[model samples]
Target: MSHKKALEAFYHKLRNLRGNTRFVGGSLILFSGDFRQTLLVIPRSTPTDELNPYLNSSVLWRHLHKLTLKTNMRVQQQRDASAGNFAKQLMDIGNEWIQIDESSNVSPCHQTSVRSLKA
Candidate 1:
């Protein structure tokens, strides 16, 4: 099916499931490089009789905001863990670069030649 059709079907399924209590505690997470750019594509076509759940001011949008707030709080509580992970990643990258630089054999003769060329 087409992209629009698939999204509509997904939203329809969600609407139907929304009334059912068995599917409680479900969540949807959307990540974008630029939220404004992503929002610009909402309701892809012109204003229609039907509303898209993905658009701003929709029920899902409100839920997303709530989720974002909760996530931010949890992240704040784990600031030390986040910093540790960031430092680990930085060290890994630095070690990889060091290995690469060491592996590339540049002889002393080559260094002397480069220095002489500068003179």
Candidate 2:
């Protein structure tokens, strides 16, 4: 199946089984593996750029109160790449938040935190 179709089907099934009482809460953590290296039960090859944001903004992310981990279960090479990309993406998002806050005249505590981040 094409990546888009597979994702659609996955979401459909998730929606169907969402309130089946087997699962605990509204959170659904979907982990996609490297196309070159299979990690989880789901298909091994999907475009990360296309799905990363969807995963981040999905019900799981929105509902979950905390994010304990975001680690790749693949081997060293894929793990390193995923980790680096994840870290950079997080930092960029944080910086964007700081920029937005600065434009709005952030509170003193937030300003201090931003300065510490810059350092």
Candidate 3:
């Protein structure tokens, strides 16, 4: 994730280079990456401190609109329903949209995949 200052710097540079008064010289900036994902990993820093450099901390963040992607293109290309389910599960965990309780019993998947993963 880019720091807000870095984004602002590029924004101003782009605006100046294009010779337009509009933001980013009215050029559509397609900012990728999921903002909903994990916060910036900081060693020996508090959560508040970590957020200080995040893109959303900038004043420009309010003006930008967010668009969500509805489909997993990789899963679609692979033509695998199981892959879709796996991707959904991973995304759910990453987004904190679902919770799975840790149990003592090991799943058959874990038992089977461990060997394959080691190989």
Model 1's TM-score against the true structure:
0.24
* Candidate 3 lDDT by residue in tens digits, 1-119: 78899889988999899999898889999998867767878899998998999898898888789888978898999998899999999889877998666875566764433345664
Query: 1 or 2, which is superior by lDDT?
Result: 2
Q: Go through the candidates in order and give each one's C-alpha lDDT.
A: 0.46, 0.49, 0.85
Candidate 2 per-residue C-alpha lDDT over 1-119 given as tens digits, one digit per residue, 9 for 90 to 100: 13444554665676677755333324455554433323233466577554543434355345434433344344335657767777667656745643454467745664433345563
Pairs that clash in candidate 1: none
The local lDDT score (0 to 100) that residue 43 gets in candidate 3 is 96
Misplaced by over 4 Å in model 2 are 20-25, 35-119
| TM-score to true structure, per model | 0.24, 0.23, 0.69
Worst 10 residues of 3 by lDDT: 110-119
Question: What is every candidate's alpha-carbon RMSD to the true fold?
Answer: 16.0, 16.1, 8.2
Evaluate residue 119 in candidate 1 and report its C-alpha lDDT on the 0 to 100 scale. 45
lDDT of 1: 0.46
**Candidate 1 lDDT, 16-40, residue by residue in tens:** 7776432222535453332223223
